[model samples]
Target chain A: MRSWKNHVRGELQQRDQTEKLPFIGVFTSLSQMEERFEFRKTCLDDVQSKSLDRGGREVGKDTRLLQLQLRESEHLAEKLSQTVSDLTTVLYLKEAELQYWQSRVSHFRQEALSLAKGSNAMKATLSEFEYTVECQSKELAALRTEQKGINQALEQACREKEELLQRWMEEKREEADRLNKYNAAQERWQRFAKQLKKHLHNARTKEFVPIVTSSWCGEAEMSTSVIQRINNTYRDTTMSKL
Target chain B: MADDKDVLRDVWFGRIPTCFLLNQDEVTEREAEPYYLLLPRVSYLTLVTDKVKKHFHKVIRTDDAEEMWFEYEGTPLKWHYPIGVLFDLHASNTVLPWSITVHFKNFPERDLLHCPSHSVIEAHFMSSIKEADALKHKSQVVNDMQKKDHKQLWMGLQNDKFDQFWAMNRKLMEYPTEDGGFRFIPFRIYQTLSDRPFIQKQFRPVSPEGHVHTLGDLLKEVYPVALPTEGGPKRFQVVIHGIEPLLETPLQWLSEHLSHPDSFLHICVIPVPSD
Candidate 1:
């Protein structure tokens, strides 16, 4: 039983150094300490009783074995007391760490709750913004349509102005041509009037006259005027067709 | 839209093509009053009056087979509304005392007038106090007072005529939002269906909410005369008014002739209208 107790103590104490759960290991070691103390007291009582009794050789040998067991148990009891004291400190440290973890969890939970509220508000704001954007897009489309119509009107006005300018140039060219023709006709008429006056003056003052101011002369003059009128009519008809 | 819905009730009054179930045995054997066998069945009503008092009587169904009687106390008159039966096998046949009987035949492919689209719809104008703005309610009076009598009469016909047709028609009143759901409205007739002058149309939208009165329910309330003369097929004139042009032929022909649109006309195809 003493050997088994020693093996259990060794295994339990070894676990304390290898694992982070020192508080649980220390509690198991403390339970073992109480058991070791009980074992030592029983061994010491057996040795003291054997020393007082007068038995056979067997009893004398039992007395020696009990003494040795008593010595080993006493050392084990001391080791167990130290382990129990160490267990008390470990348990205190574990309580402190647990308290720290609980407070940390609470702080993170509150932060998460506030963040969730903020995100929800952001979502609502985003939705309203999206709605506004949609309305703006529709209004922009309408404005663009109106602008397109105005641009088209402006382009049409420009085209009309260009056409009007071209027509004005055409009319000016035709007017200039008519003015030139009228001026030429006026000059010819003025020359004819001068010649007629000069001939009449000659008839009154000069002593001699050309062969005859006769019926043949008058007929020839009328025939030549008719031929000029026919030539002018042919030329005007040809000009109009061209 | 609600105003338009109320008009749907009136739309079926004269609109549905009514069929005649004449006692062929009487109309043919005896000289009768414009009675032709409706081949199908009908639900009708009657209002009685005298020098001193006014009585109202309504017969929901008519039977030719057995004797049946009903008495409503203190009221001088009786009113019956025939709850329409949709299929014949589903129908229960019964005879009102001194009245006629209706047999919704399971397989009457031969005897049936088979009014295809033509239908005569009876108005079930029952009134109530709920919604005062509503002068009349187009509903069945299956309330507590009417429940016992209704059960008694309906059960009396359960032997041969189980109202299998009526039961089937009742099952059809689901999904009211659907287009043709109202077409199966129990007691009302087809809109624009006519037979009198034969004013007709090739197409009409059937309003589903038209009320219906079954022939079985109508005969259950007919007042028996003291003379108790053997009644043949009681020729009842169900006068109706609102109608459409295209559905007149089928409606009129079915009531007067027991003919459906497809059965009577060679070209019986009606184009369904959309809203």
Candidate 2:
């Protein structure tokens, strides 16, 4: 009995070792602990084995889940790289278009400057042409004025010439009248001289008493004598029967 | 037409000294040739006035009567023979053949002033104007009036140089008939001289009216037709007629020329018997 009692006391003191195992270990009350202990050793061993198997299977399933997460990360990196390449191609095309527009704008500015210079040159030429036209118009107007003045002078000279000719004709008529009057007086004087000669000849012959005849008769006799002398003057015998 | 004009130019401008243009009725071509030949033979011609001298340039027929008493018109109102005609009862004077171109002791250059052809005619049957020549001129007038046609005779010739003609007056008074005026009788007058300056005043009845006019009235009109005859200086004790049918009425008197200085006829102024 005594030996049996000692064994019980030692087992009870070694209870801590069994408490770490099994289905229900480390019970608070000693009675249960004792009951379990008294219940059977096989039952405790079966429970420990079942615990080990469950822990190992759970660790393996956790490793398979980590491998699936790594494959998903690699697929995401490939898709991001393809999207960046596409963006670079689109930027290059936009830069080339900007350079072409800059060149075209510079060429258009140069053309505009040249056109402005040509326009200024044309404006100066037009001003010179306009001034030449003004000078020509002034010269033509002066010539027209001079031509009119000369025409007026010519008309005045013609009128003066006509007036002078009319005055000359009147003077000629007066001269003709003067010549006629002188001839008549000369004829009258010649008749008186002839009669005196005839009377002197008759007195020298001593034919009759000296008596003065009519003054008109002596003048008539003198006229006859003077005409006879004139008849005998040129080609004296030419007009004998005068 | 151009050729005809050239021919006429030759005829008009041709100037040989003597030229004869005879009407075919008066002279044939052959007869005119002789006169052209004779033209050069006449060396001298007598002229009474400067006007007459121009007509007879170098063709003179006589040189004896170079000095004579005659008168021509002058200008500026000198004294001219305005009225030397005799009235119906005026005196008669006889003037000798006073040559207008020449004269005797009474030589005068003034003769052409009164008569153009004074040298060609004598004033025989005229008024007795000079005391010396009046008695002889009166006797000569009485002898001239006895002839039957004596009254129609040319008593004197007066020079009319302005008219370029001679004024031949009859021995009797003659009437002048102007178209719109009253009739007037003009008796011919002449100057006469005999011894020294003897003058006689005598006149017979002259122009009697025919159509109530006198015989002398008709003679005045007829004188112009006969005075141009060649025998004017010779036959003019009377007015010598060359045309036939003596002057009762002078009408249509065309010239029928005979030989000059010999062929002579007389014109009578007798009273016509009352109808």
Candidate 3:
């Protein structure tokens, strides 16, 4: 009886160690604990039956021993009840902890799903933007090339216009210089013609007066005609200047 | 010869090819031919108009043909202004003749109707002149007749003196006759400038002086209503090809800065922060 009690105590100690390992270890140790509980119940029943048989054979001598055995069995029953209560308390705590962990995992999963959806939307917009940027850049390059060609043509036209204007100015200056020279020459010629006309008139009056009184009418007419002819020639030349 | 510097040289005038009709409805392309007048530069437009009238009378034999006036591209020309000034203002070259249209006096609405033959029209016109002449006294008629006959006395006057005298006395001599009307005619002149073409541009009003307008004003004038208004501020950029952006510049200076006579200007506009 003493050895059986010691064995039961050792078994209970082993179950406690197994239960304390972790929540996962608790499930494996649950079947072992049940087996030990059943063994303890049967051992108590056998010890009670042996105590009854010994009381009938040696009533006076086994009375004190039987009473002591009764007290020890009661003590063992209290210890088993305490251990069972402790195990129930451990199971409740483990269940509550498991429920909390499950809720946290579900919340994390939902957050990940939402973040993935947002990433997909951003990627779609990014690709569209990239395509538009590429097309615009190509168009810009073509436009720049055309603009360069136009600028070159404009520059050439401007240069040609400037050159033409310069040439026109030079020609105008030459014309003005020629006009001034011609005007000066015309003034000199007019003065010389006037002096020549005066000399001819004086010569006719001073030298031909006596000749004219004689019958030299034909000579006088010829001189006058010659003078008129010369005057006509000078007038014609002056008119041409205009 | 004394006023030779004031003489007009290389002047040009325009003549309508056919007799002008008094009715606006009778105007046609056939009469639109612009003939170059071969008059001397010193000759006045009045001489051109008189010559045109004589040619029409000689060719058509229509005694009651209405009087005509000259218009250049719809602007009526004054009879006294020298044709040279007109040529200078409109045409760069002196030789090219101007284009003109001849409009008749009160034809479509009033005169020159219901006449059958030349004799009847002549008789009617003669009776009107006789009636007008009879209304004046014999002494006044003699004085007017002598003045008309002695036009050659003043014909050799210088152009400036003649123009001034005519400008002042033209209204005095044009007194209404017994028929309550007067006879007047105009002659148009044109000269085409092939080498130097004139270009004019009007800007949108922007300031109190009315010289400049914003760039948006130009865009609005060009495109009637294509822009959409948003709640936010709208910004746009203009890019002129071969030139810098033309923002915040005075509208009066825009044409001078961007334009040359020979080259074509290209412009581009872009909107900012498009949604």
Candidate that scores best on TM-score: 1
Q: Which candidate ranks first by lDDT, i.e. highest? A: 3
Instruction: For residues A158-199, write the lDDT of model 2, one tens digit per residue.
Output: 889889878887787766665554445445545644665665
CAPRI quality of model 1: incorrect
Clashes of each: 81, 78, 2
lDDT tens digits by residue: candidate 1, B105-223: 23244322232211121112122111110211122223322434433333322211222212221221122333422222122322112332222222212423542322222222221
For residue B213, give model 2's deviation from the true position in Å.
Answer: 99
Model 2 over residues B155-209: C-alpha lDDT tens digits? 2113211111101111111112222111221222222221222111222122334
lDDT of each: 0.34, 0.31, 0.42
User: What lDDT is obtained when candidate 2 is compared to the true structure?
Assistant: 0.31
* lDDT for B197 (candidate 1): 21
Worst 10 residues of 3 chain A by lDDT: A15-24
Ranking by TM-score: 1, 3, 2
TM-score of each: 0.26, 0.18, 0.26
